[model samples]
Target: MPATFSTLAEFRTLLTHAPKIDAIALGEAQDRNGQLTKPPGALGRLEDLAIWYAGWRGTARPSIDAPQVIIFAGNHGVTAQGVSAFPAEVTEQMVMNFQHGGAAINQLSKAAGASLDVHALSLDVPTQDFTQTSAMDEAGVVDALVAGWNAVAPHTDLLVVGEMGIGNTTSAAAIAHALFGGQAEDWVGRGTGVDDAGLANKARVVREAVALHAGGDGLDTLMRLGGRELAAMAGAIAKARSLRIPVILDGFICTAAAACLAQTQPDALDHTVAGHASAEAAHRALLAQLDKQPLLALNMRLGEGSGGALAINILKSAVACHSGMATFAEAGVSDA
Candidate 1:
């Protein structure tokens, strides 16, 4: 289905209304964790992650099932500025690759026993160059976001969002600069392994775009600079939170979307997790803004949701440890 939005303000209201996680479940989950067979805190962050899910799902013993990775595919007109190593058509090619099960995310998701879906957005049109004008106006953004939100609505247990857009890092950096008030050089990264020349061009393009939209509000900044995929992910994250689902973000571009949602609603990241730390320089700063510690550090810069696919096993492990293990009483083991 195509995306639709009544207005920018109305869409913002939908995003901000995603319900907060239930804290009462947190206490019960923690108490159950303390009574588990393992010593207190022995499992460390795994225990913490399990409890975090418990609060979101409102389940004392949260279990992960039917984990799905949805990759949003779009093309950025900003590539005309030489921001990425690949050309714009590669976005369409990669989307085709995903459909044919020839991409890294396909292999990773299969190995993890998770489902993978790809949404091809703007197959015929790239977002207009934001350095000149808005990549997508409020109406366009609403359509993209609604598509993403519906793509994610089917799965309630675990959702991982990845992107397949060329030049998206530049768009993400522009959003970071607007929302975080940072210089473009600090936010731009060597997307797709750009060389020295391409890196300078990427930074320059981002800086120019950020300047174009300076002093604009958050939604305005996003509409001006952020592309369709990022808008979709932000909407999906917010909507998933409303459904009490946990979202694992893929890499820098995906995290940038999460950062947008968090900037809009501070508690938005409460139900989110960083799949891994990207090799992208700006990703660390973006994660810091959301206060999310990644579950992996594979030094990956690929953006096809590969990192998120890898991290799905870790989340499943947390679920297994939380639900499968027996308590001291059930195991007939007494504490000394």
Candidate 2:
């Protein structure tokens, strides 16, 4: 059977109207945790993160079975303006590195025992002998993203979205400004080690790109400056939410794609967990605007889902405690 795509409006409403956390189950999980022969609250946020996961999945035995990370790679048009420190060819190079298990994400994913899927939605400069597909348009973005979701939907219990694009940070900042009504100065930041002058130039380029794409639809802005991978990631988020799957989001560029998805479908945030606090200033502002709390703050600037993969370990530990720790009753200990 062919897959069906959910509209942004419908997704927004469904997420908004989704049921609240199950208080009884949450309380039970908390009580069980307290009676597990350990100091109360000793686990810190892991306890809370675990209980939240319990409520999120509505099961005390909530497990992160089949955890998978999807890293979307593409090329941004803003690279033409020299805003980024790295050359645009870096996008294709990094995509290859990801496929070959040489990137940070590869190491992190292996450590966390999560599967990795790399998508090359668009490569401005294609590399010979690389296994990647073409850049996708708006509809193509929807189809490709939805197809990926359908392929993994039945087996995966958790999903993480990451991005790899040379000038994508600029493109993401531009999208943040255009859709969220922030100034170019408010949304722009140093991407890949741009100096002070380079940062100013990056901001100016973003401002210009925002001006050029102003007063048009969201999808148009995506097609103009946004990479194909970002657009595909946005669609992936929507499809995951429609399937009631929880999504973990990466740094600034991924969050920018997510912001675009949220603008189109506000409820998408309901199923999302911000994975890290990026060093990029724009990332801080975007997280503030979205009202999200990241799971980690490691001054990480590298993208490719490395931060998200690191955060997954915490999530895994949380689920382990929730599912495997014994209650006082199970341990034959009296509760005081």
Candidate 3:
């Protein structure tokens, strides 16, 4: 596909018209849930999630089909500051963990029965030997993301985007400030559990990074501070919407990338489901702008798509209710 959007408004309109919850399918799902062996409303949110999934896919019997998880790993220049307890080298190590199938996301994905693809995006770090993929520039990010979308386009019914980059929260805050035009302090937060002094340092780093790339456009901001993984995530979102595939976003970093994508193409939000609200205050602001209510709020700040894996179970429950339950007419139950 061509990597062009005449205007942000045009992109937004394209996303808005993307796949939506199917009211008819949702109604059918609720009816089926009522027909389940359990009492009505007994299944709680599980049933609700199933109905929502059915509606979102516009199918009375929606399935995850080829469930795939894309984990984008990169390094951040802002990590040079003491924002995180871990060093930038850990990003490479964790990418190895992902390749070796030992990370939390790997285990959770296995438990959830979802396939995984790890993309080693080049940002500020040297390319390593763990599944070496091309580094993404502004245009490269868009193209790589679109290619990823096309790779899984035909098989998957849903998409989950996860990221791993040390000091990514710093990059996220900078992007958030640029896209939303907020103070760096307003977008900055304690990433990886930084204490008072550490947070202050992180805030300072963010302010400097934002100042470094004062202006240009969204793509410029992304290239200057945003990791290649985040850029690819933004592109993946656009491609996903173009394919009408639903995506579940992870944490602050992923949400920030989504925000960048949304700024470029507002309608992308239409196909996205906020997995959870991060403890990061900036995440709250980002979700508010998207007008998305998260599925969970366990104060989780892990950036390996753990939240997305957790949310997948809820989505599965929704699918089960919609596909397995019976309707009132089939169950001989009274409408009244």
Candidate 4:
């Protein structure tokens, strides 16, 4: 669907008016779960996952037939601060790899039967270093937001938004520290295999950036400290909430993007679940702040929505068992 709003103010208004889950579907799904021919709580979290997913899809017995993974790539100007192990050129190169189906996310998406789409946001023109000024002005951030908003296909039943921007971990750390009011080291992590010295430098950069761009609300914080890809992830997540599509959030950077939403509106992430707790050291803490329990935790930290893509199968299995299993009467099984 086309974007119905453009500016950040309009976007914030859109968020305030997002659709809520289908309560009738939730009730019916709960009723069906009770009669699924299994002992109570036998499926553990899967039962809850199915019910939550059912409410979002507006069907008591819903299947995830059309899962979509969107990867948003952007070059960050913060790499100039030596905050990343890899250079910015890799962002564009990785986009090409994703296009060629050669990246890990491509294989994971295919394995989970999800269609993949990638949007590279202005690779040649990176965001401002942000240590000097806000990473993006209102216009730049809005464009990225709109890009993410329009990228979600209206027919998609399940959504996963990922990022492929170098130096974004620093941006994530800065955003987290700014929003959560923590020391910089508390939120910084070794991203892209940076060395110990590089890690310290990364933390320092986060501290300085957050100090410079402190005291803004979620959207202001995003515009000040977040890159285009980060803003885009936030945008896609908001769009998913508006369309009532259940989202499987990726790792730390993705969670940081989602954090902007949570800070903006407490219930903005009601439709999203943590796909995985990544190897990123602070990801667990970030997930905790969002009150999201990840569905998987394989010590995986390779981004590009790889973790979320892997989780599609887990959600699929939950829905399959919930919707496809026969009730006790249908199976002629005695509940007693």
Q: lDDT scores for all predictions?
A: 0.84, 0.72, 0.71, 0.93
Off by over 4 Å in 4: none
Sorting all predicted structures by lDDT, with the top scorer first, yields 4, 1, 2, 3
Report lDDT (Cα) of residue 274, candidate 4: 94
Q: What's the best-to-worst order under TM-score?
A: 4, 1, 2, 3
Q: Residue-wise lDDT of candidate 2 within 1-336, one digit each (tens)? A: 134545434434543554555677777777767777567887888888887777656676678877888888877655656778998788888889899988899989888888999987647542111001122344555554454445444566777878888877777887788887867888888878889898888788777766766665455555455666677677676656655567788898888878876665455577778899999888878888788899999999887877888888888898898788887789887777
Number of backbone clashes in candidate 4: 0
In candidate 4, which residue pairs get closer than 3 Å at backbone N, Cα or C atoms, i.e. clash?
none
CA lDDT of 153 in candidate 4? 92
Per-residue lDDT of model 1, residues 161-220, tens digit only: 888888898998989888897678899888888888888888889888887887755667
In Å, residue 58's CA in model 1 sits off its true spot by: 1.3
Residue-level lDDT for 13 in candidate 4: 92
Candidate 3 clash pair list: 21-55, 22-55, 50-318
**Per-model TM-score versus the true fold:** 0.96, 0.84, 0.81, 0.99
How many pairs of residues collide in each model? 0, 0, 3, 0
Error (Å) of candidate 1 at residue 284 is: 0.9
How well is each residue in 79-176 modelled by candidate 3, as lDDT tens digits?
A: 54567778888888899999999889999888888888888766445322111222234454444454444444446667788888877887788788
Top model number, lDDT? 4
As a whole number from 0 to 100, the lDDT of residue 283 in candidate 2 is 88
Mark the 10 consecutive residues where model 4 has the least summed lDDT.
1-10
